[model samples]
Target: MVEVKLHDIGEGMTEADINCYLVKPGDFVKADDPLVEVQTDKMTAEIPAPRSGVIKELLLTPGQTVKVGTTLLIMEDSSGGSKTVELQKVAEAVNSEAPQADAAVVVLDRPAEVKVPVGVSARLGRILASPYTRKVARENAVNIMEVKGTGPAGRITEEDILAFVKLRDHGGASTSEAGSEQQVPNISKYASEQEVPNVSQRASESKAPNVSEVGSEVKTAAGHETVGKSQDILPFRGRRKQIAKKMVQSIYTIPHCTHFEEIDVSELIALREEIKASGNSISATAFFIKALSIGLKEFPVFNAKLDEENESIQLLREHHIGIAVDTPEGLIVPVIRNVEQKNLKQIHDEMKRLTKLALDDKLTVQDISGGTFTISNVGPLGGSIGATPIIQHPQTALVSFHKTKKRPVATDQDEIVIRSIMNLSMAFDHRVADGATAVAFTNRFAQLIENPKLMLLELM
Candidate 1:
């Protein structure tokens, strides 16, 4: 038997929730087979098996959070070895605290299960809740099990608590003891209330929502009313949860300020057409990427990050720009590395490759790693004219490029003329640069878009 520990899967992600278990005890598996799906802070990934084996036991449940390096399960390898011999080897390996540990894996014999106290599980129905949800429930003094959980397997979630609070208070109607009357279930005296000692501290941060909840009925200030439609409760796991985690961290840590401007892209459009006419496949995003790389060189702060501990700035020399791609799975930002080294065609081809891999769910951590900056083209998706985008964390800046259209603009001679104009919505970490610096970077970027010759010159 080998111990299956939760591996450190992503870029510095220390903990994750077991989103789902693909196998159960007694199931046979092959090496590289997906044993479970895990949702980390950065992404949703499948943890594959290291060796073929029959599952011995599952130590966790869905929505149960665990830290990296925690032993999640014990699986017996199907190598036709004697059970007693394998167990002996495992015991030896565990007892061996040698200076140089062997490559062979050791699995602990399953500990004897302590019978759950009588009447506890029967009363509370196990009260399974994510750490974040449990934290919220404790803060609000709500017994999580009393609340009818709308989550998978009747699991209580953070949103359930939020909705419960809202329905009880009726939009802050009264903060008296009266508000507590119409509340959820209470914990029985027998409920365990034992905390999982090994849970990650980040789980109690209250930054990310555990699930999306909507109350079926809410009391309006005038009176009570039905919500009219059945509400859908979505599990805040997988990619959505990852996005929420990063966005929350970004908003709380970075003092972000956006600089908005417009640029005429008629010349850039004409250049794209000319290239396409020559049987090339360069994209509009490639143009923006090249322009942004040149702009970053001109204004280094836009490509830099603020190191608060060291009280200094770290300016990155390479131009690895992340393109925010909205895939069916979720919003994934795949990085285009060393944009300054690649020509327009190269950028286009790489973007297509990365986007395809992302959509196909074949993108490895390396494919999406190492972004010095980000650009999100939210315009083509067709929602609003512009956007005040949130900065991707650890990176200092992100620019939201909106749709281009034939809009009337005043020429140098003050005559109104139609031009293909687009909006550039950019946000920068204030600690890294001031508004003037951000504007300077955007201005240089805009100039390159207006005149392709300058961008081509940068390439030379």
Candidate 2:
């Protein structure tokens, strides 16, 4: 039997949540067949089977986070009839600690199952609470099974526990003394007998509602009576949760600095129009990507990631640029590999194809991996002239492009003319690049865009 471990899916991914399992035990699968789907911070991807085999066992579950090198599934090679012989080979390959050790003697065992003990009342359908709530209930020595559920589907949520606590406190009864009410002795006679005021009575009288009674409605100044909506209480799950974690990590770990520049792109616009008039359609983003790739070649420092663990910076030779495509579901970056090697027409065609694939939800893991830099264009929607964009992690910089507008600029010593002007904003990791370097890089980029001939030469 061969065990399939989680392989590196790129973008510095160390772990992934198992979104779904496509196959079950005893099912035959072919080589390259999708075995499972995994969701990372960027995208959801299908993990394909390595070889034709019958699934022996599934080791992971949906919504469970798994790390790299963690075994996901066990498979029996159909071509190899002897399971023992195949497993021995797998053991030899996986266990590289002792090369001279005997592989046949080593045994691989399945992991043990963990059993969560349920209370007697809970098992009798008297309780409906989440695992976390049940743990809290056990810690407080409170029987959740006796507490009525106030959440959807008769599930006991955290709010229900708080409400229960309030009720217990106001009711003035211990769990042991629940069914009994103490007789009120004559206070005046008791005071006379003790010759002092009862301090316990004063303390009991001071207990009141902390805020308001449970199930009370809140009203706004607009006279709208608002009720607490359960829909607003959403679980942090899936892509949205993944994005939040990554954003926090990026902001806290990476030191970022932004540089902005405005450039006249009249020549580039003319070239685009000339091409389009010849029955060729291309997006402005494609033009910007082609220009940015050339600029990266001139300033290699901007195309790098900070290796904090190694206490060094990595400069990459490959020019794979990620284009951020906004989809209805979320934002996805589909990388175009080796942009320096492709012609402008080829780049334009690939961008068009990838953008369509992105919008249609047809992009694959291969299309989204291995980005050295990123470009996000806000020109199509016609928004702000310039704004700093957050850099996608593992990539050192991102370029934000704004809409082109016609503005008056000096054409020569004697006259002024209308030209197409746009803003280019570059946000970089300050740990890898400085302000002067960023300015120089963006200047070269603007030069290429302003002079179409220079951009064409760079493409060559």
The local distance difference test score of each candidate is: 0.68, 0.66
Give the local distance difference test score of model 2.
0.66
- Kindly list the per-residue Cα lDDT of model 1 for residues 1-460, writing each as its tens digit: 7888899876777678786555555444557756666766545676777886666778997777788898888888868466534543543453242212111122333332332211112111233355346557656756443454556534556677777677666654232321221212222221123222212232232323444547778656698586853445666665676678889999999998988999899998898898889998688988888889888888888888788899999999999999888865478888899997888888889998998876645677887888999999877876557777899889999999998889898989999998998888999998878998888788888888999878767655
**Tens-place lDDT digits, model 2, residues 247-302:** 77877777888898998888887888988999987666777777788888889988
Q: What does the lDDT read for residue 105 in candidate 2? A: 18
Per-candidate TM vs. native?
0.68, 0.60
Best by lDDT: 1
Worst 10 residues of 1 by lDDT: 115-124
For model 1, the stretches where C-alpha displacement exceeds 4 angstroms are 27-33, 41-44, 50-54, 76-81, 84-229
TM-score of 1: 0.68
On TM-score, the candidate that comes out on top is 1
